[model samples]
Target chain A: MPQTGRSGCPINLTLEQLGDRWSLIVIRDVMFGNRRSYGELLAQSEEGIASNILADRLKRLTASGLLTRRPDPKHRQKGIYSLTEAAIQLVPLLAHMGAWGRRHTRSSKELSVRAELLEKGGAPLWNAFMDELRHLHLGAPRPARSVFGELQAAYEKALARRARYAQD
Target chain B: MPQTGRSGCPINLTLEQLGDRWSLIVIRDVMFGNRRSYGELLAQSEEGIASNILADRLKRLTASGLLTRRPDPKHRQKGIYSLTEAAIQLVPLLAHMGAWGRRHTRSSKELSVRAELLEKGGAPLWNAFMDELRHLHLGAPRPARSVFGELQAAYEKALARRARYAQD
Candidate 1:
């Protein structure tokens, strides 16, 4: 991110903030997997994000106000990263991105299952998911909707299906 | 980009397609500015994209199936570019991204005006805009809604407002 010198398009501004592949990947991990600590994010990285890159993205996201880092009370040195309201609002955009990818890419059955659910679930699901995120990351009241649970269950089922297919 | 071995998250796959800053900028020009020719895109660029980068992104986008290119009938050697159905479907994601930028970044008022309209207009406007994009880029029958017109008018109005403010 450069100094705030832009007087240009909003999408360009957004691309500056999020165009880096790793930034959104990190955000996805946090948003979906509830990976907060650096260790959790690094350990669970499906794309094998490098340590230095993860560190830099975490710093950048914090600086960009998409995330906030607070010292983990359980550990002196560790930080717990939480999504801000702005990032919570990204549910729809993420849903759209996922939906687009599932439709267009050679995405795997197991991985794309979530996107399929999101596309099927639409705005109501996205909003419910956002409320859930707010509860998880921002201390908002817990919503009755369990989109996160549903998405996780779907992913697990797809994984099982892939496993059975692989055995054949 | 790396030959479709990915069996990962849809957002990651989508990010692989769209994480580049220049690609979306070029798409924005085509979608919003209606700049199909390389010459037209180069001349009207607000962010001063280099010719080589633009050419390369155009080639990549065409190869990636988000855009298609055909030799301009009016010109011997020049080519005209147009968005594919997949690209047209990106309106909602682009709208969300622009809205996020407007909310979080130092985006100028005149530039962010379009984002504001999209955010306020929401899905109906985005669907209308997509229909208009389909009409322009895919030879679909022209829709009754003219979101493109409204966005263009709003942008021009903002530009005039900017010009007036610059005098002070």
Candidate 2:
């Protein structure tokens, strides 16, 4: 059984753990591919989260078992962040949120592209995405490569497009 | 076309509008039972949202097109709050959130029961619930008596259970 802290509502508890504005963005960055260091998250976020708040949210997220941090293998000074199993379970929630937002909010080309893919992919896409991450990061059994090759390709394409705009 | 106020990412915009802790709770109260009167909201909520903040949220929600407020027919000083189409759309989101929380968090019996019902009923239940509200507030056609009857039974059961443990 999961632990109940104070409130009895599940949504309230989830909010207590991951409701802040910055936390989900951080998770998004990590899930999407920006997991190298804190600086990357700070620079890439659209919300312009403050440095202190970002740092605090990262620490809280780590402590809450949503994410884990390790010293960067390439650079001792940098911290490499990765999602735990608990955090990966959030893919469905994130996908739904993204789809909802896409339906209601003004669409950016990039956001709409991502949302469209997420909508089509649904739970299978989310599960496959999680499986790939687990295989890559934690040495879990490699899922059938065919399952995620297209997703990986699309994600890479998105990343390249982002890089061009990011440099300009 | 949906208007994106900021970036194209639907999740970010949604977060900007409905991500706050209190906003969803306020919406839940209005959708579930709490209708008009500021005092009733304050009295019922266990979170004890600050009056100024609650007032501000209510105003913002109304301005944002999620809720509507009208002069209460019974009490001139009171404003009867009703959910707009946009707010009604959030029933599924809230239901999903509640379901996720129940699966992952330790919650009270009352909340757990509600979550279980929501999970079992899914979108159909959400639609039925919203249709009932529309009829009550907007004079839409009434739904099947059985549908309303089941919803009322569940809602009343939850309320009574909550009252047993109500704090002063």
For all the predictions, what are the DockQ values?
A: 0.72, 0.52
DockQ of 1: 0.72
Isolated chain B TM-score per model: 0.94, 0.83
lDDT of 2 by residue, A37-71 (tens): 79988887776778998898788888878888899
B-chain TM-score, candidate 2 = 0.83
lDDT of 2 at B144: 76
Give one clash count per candidate, in the order shown: 0, 3
lDDT of each: 0.87, 0.72
Poorly placed runs, candidate 2 (over 4 Å): A1-6, A34-36, A136-138, A145-168, B1-6, B136-138, B145-152, B155-168
Residues B1-168, candidate 2: write the lDDT tens digits. 122354556777888787766788788777664455677887776566689988988888888888888988888888878888777777667777777777766766665666678779866787788787777657789887444467557767987977876853
TM-score of 1: 0.94
iRMS per model, in Å, is: 1.4, 1.9
- The Cα error of candidate 2 at residue A22, in Å, is 1.5
Model 2 interface RMSD, in angstroms? 1.9
